[model samples]
Target: MTDFITRFAPSPTGPLHLGHAYSAILAHDMARAANGQFLLRIEDTDLQRSKPEWDALIRQDLTWLGLHWDGPVLRQSMQLTSYDTYLAQLAARDLLYPCSCSRADIRAALTAPQEGHPHEVYPGTCKQRLMSDRKPGDALRLHLDRALALLTDDFPRFVETGEAHKGTHQIDPSQAHTQIGDVVLSRKGEDIVAYFLASAIDDARQDITHVIRGEDLFDFTAIQVILLTLLNLPVPTYHHHRLIRDDHGKRLAKRDDARAIATYRAEGKTPADIRAMIGL
Candidate 1:
């Protein structure tokens, strides 16, 4: 059997909150219980929003939680060259196109009858457009149709772990073609690397066997699976756990300063208290 390798990838955009603690503990506990390896990945993909102080705080917070990773911490910000290599490969296959559409323009375009997937769907406005016509500020997007064709031409079926995914999950070529339209692989700001693309590449490079994250990102699994197929990378088993909500039952956000782990720690809340508070 393959050794289990799991990761707790947290973005260093803000201080670690209760939600972050829950995820870190869960991933660490799972790894410990199975004698598996627990890895820490700093997902500071958005360089503009990510801060050095926040990164330091993340290390401190996790250490306070008594969780230790097996390997040196991996930071996504340092892997731009790797992302560029993958981008070039996709572009060479004609599976990527430059998109000049702004967020407002996309929303306007989607105002009409929605034809494809629901969550953050990107209509194929620039899928077939010539690259020369795109402005310098345009974002790079993956041509879903081309990606699907490539996947279907190679591996026609994919099955995800039933234990982690609730049941065996298969990706039909036709469904992937329709549901996952063109998605943004990179944007203009800060050298053009986006979360979806960077994350997919990093996960493969890290040799992660399992991805345990919040359930809020469950819908995003489809797009990641598609990217893995296009890149010919092995897809990891995914476990989307329940989120830590606020007093109003809303999902915790970084802006919720009162719920920040630092605040909880300052209030003399023990790690055991944190585990109980989050029902770990």
Candidate 2:
């Protein structure tokens, strides 16, 4: 909480729900309490679903909640070239390989339980394949093994402030592979950059010192830490707060129109009512 700089980044694919409001309010209040900066980042990397109208709606929603940001909003769509530069660097170092595996192929490969937690770990079918020999429909994947190998004496670490996992934790190679497999750095064709890659880069680029988001993203943070280490970026302290859930204990989704902030606003629910509802 010392000179903290946090962000409330939301993808413009859908309406802002109660969970979104809690995260935004938490980040904004934390920054305010510490006399630091709070930022807004539009994670619209998924071109097909993201809409400019949705972006505007997100702004309106946050403003209604009285969570004003410190500066102009940072859009991920505008930083594709910057992301490409980082991807090129990884490719040059031979830390990335072309993956031609389709979703069905990946599913089938993951079906055969070899080791680990039997989760969907990439079977590394295309690890040995070179990018030069790959076809036009290939996607780029981070060679996690190679990336970890490069970090020799300089071990990657991150500070976690969440209730579930707290303290300084050093990222272990075996655990990284077991928990999160070789993640795709880029997609098959358009909007090649993956969420993990782009968001990590964006966080570092914006000088984010603290990442305040929902606890659901807690697992994926280790992967982002790995990417930040490889790219020589500043690793921020993460505060994964509790998620807003429904009566049945299900996380709120964009399709949950009943829990959407806009819907609540139309129903005459105040921002104070929102804070009380989310246990803020």
Candidate 3:
């Protein structure tokens, strides 16, 4: 088998900030320490928000941080056909259906309040809808109930490290059914790939063995794990690292221009300074 392969996939919707630098450095450090390969993936799946200039800036920022990736950089936008293939495969199995619910409709249907979660839970309004009954401008959603059944009967339980949960963790089939309901595989504006679909497919295609990312995505991991199981894709070990937060305890965002890597580089901050800043 190939050595451990880890990747740093950043959405090029905006400039790289301090949080991006910390996550990239951590992944690169781990890959280097294992004598494995570190890869770069441009997660420009959100075409409406992604920009060519930001993508170029991301490459430049990582290079300036003294982190070099192995092999050619992968771009999600260029892999739409591959995502489509997997989407079709899932649809053929009757594991996916089209939903006509809009954001406002979903929000209005949310009966219960969020319980310590960032976003309100989806009420599965479209879970039982027939694909043929839906019209265009509808989003594609996976059938989480059927997916859990296939996973529980066909595959053994899998576990991975989680930063939020303190150690190794496994997804209980029952909990997955309750918590994840049905998630979007693609949206109306997006062709046939949403973040959950594209991310799971990309990791499988790239043969990623370890996924090192920020803690904010810890909850989202469950959804991706479900997708991996449904698609019969290998589940890579995950390492959700600590996030870099500002003085207000808010996580760094692309809008935090003061924390942009370009600003730091232009201000004569060396690579060592960045390491120190992020406590690497």
Candidate 4:
């Protein structure tokens, strides 16, 4: 058996902000402390937003912060074939269906007030439709009901080692169906692979034993756990650390260039300064 393996996956959509630094440093330290391997994965799945320059800057920023990854950095762009294979497998099991609804359509369909969540819960407009029934531009969605039925009485659960919520949480299918809804596995055009699908598959493919990321993603872990279970992939322990927010208590985004590590570097802030800023 291998030692604990973890990864720091970042999209190259923009500059590496302080939040990125904190997460990367945390993942690196954890792997180093355990004498395990820390891997870097470039989540460049969004072909429209992801840029090669940003990808290069990500590496440079991590290295500047004294965080080094083991092995060659895994680029998601190079693994489209693998993603296709997994998607096909899910389709073969009848766990996936074609979704033709747009964001406007879903919002218009869901007339009832929704609870506060990070993402908008998708209304099941295309749940009954199969791939054959889909039009040319239809996207793919997971049949949540059918997928959960596969578990039957044995619902999926995962261990959370993060400070905020640490325990084995049971995934209630009823709550998931209503709250989470049927998430999109692919878009109408351009890149076919979705964030959840790609990350889940990559984690299993790299034999990642632990996933250390921001707490914003904590709520969505259940969805990924479900997908992993459906695909017969090994689920890893999760540690979602506290997020770094601005003065307004808003989570740092890639566009927060003022708080970006590169900007800090330009201002002659040392690595220790960054560590102090993010409370690492």
Over 1-280, each residue of candidate 1 has an lDDT whose tens digit, in order, gives 3478889988887889999999999989988888898999988766767899999999999999898998799998887667877878888888788888875543332221111324455767677886556676677788877777666655433334434457546666555556556767776544546667777678888898888888766656777787787777888888778888888788887888999999999999999999999999
Q: List the residue pairs that clash in candidate 2.
A: none
Over 40-84, each residue of candidate 2 has an lDDT whose tens digit, in order, gives 999887677789988999999999999899889999888777788
lDDT of 2: 0.83
Q: For candidate 3, write residues 97-184 as lDDT tens digits.
A: 8777775543222211122335444577777887776676677778877777776655444445654666555667666666556777
Task: Write down the lDDT of every candidate, Cα atoms only.
Answer: 0.75, 0.83, 0.78, 0.84
Tens digit of lDDT per residue, candidate 4, span 1-280?
Answer: 4679999999898999989888999999999999999999998877767899999999999999999999999998887667877888888988889877775543232221212334666767677887778777677788888889889889989999999999999898878887677777765555547788889999999999999998888877888999999889999999999988899888888777999999999999999999999998
Model 4's TM-score against the true structure: 0.93
TM-score of each predicted structure versus truth? 0.87, 0.92, 0.90, 0.93
Which segments of model 3 are wrong by more than 4 Å?
103-117, 154-156, 162-167
The positional error of residue 175 in candidate 3, measured at the CA in angstroms, is 3.0
Cα deviation of 4 in candidate 1 (Å)? 0.9
Ranking by lDDT: 4, 2, 3, 1
Compared with the true structure, the alpha-carbon lDDT of candidate 4 equals 0.84
Backbone atom clashes (below 3 Å) for every candidate:
0, 0, 0, 0
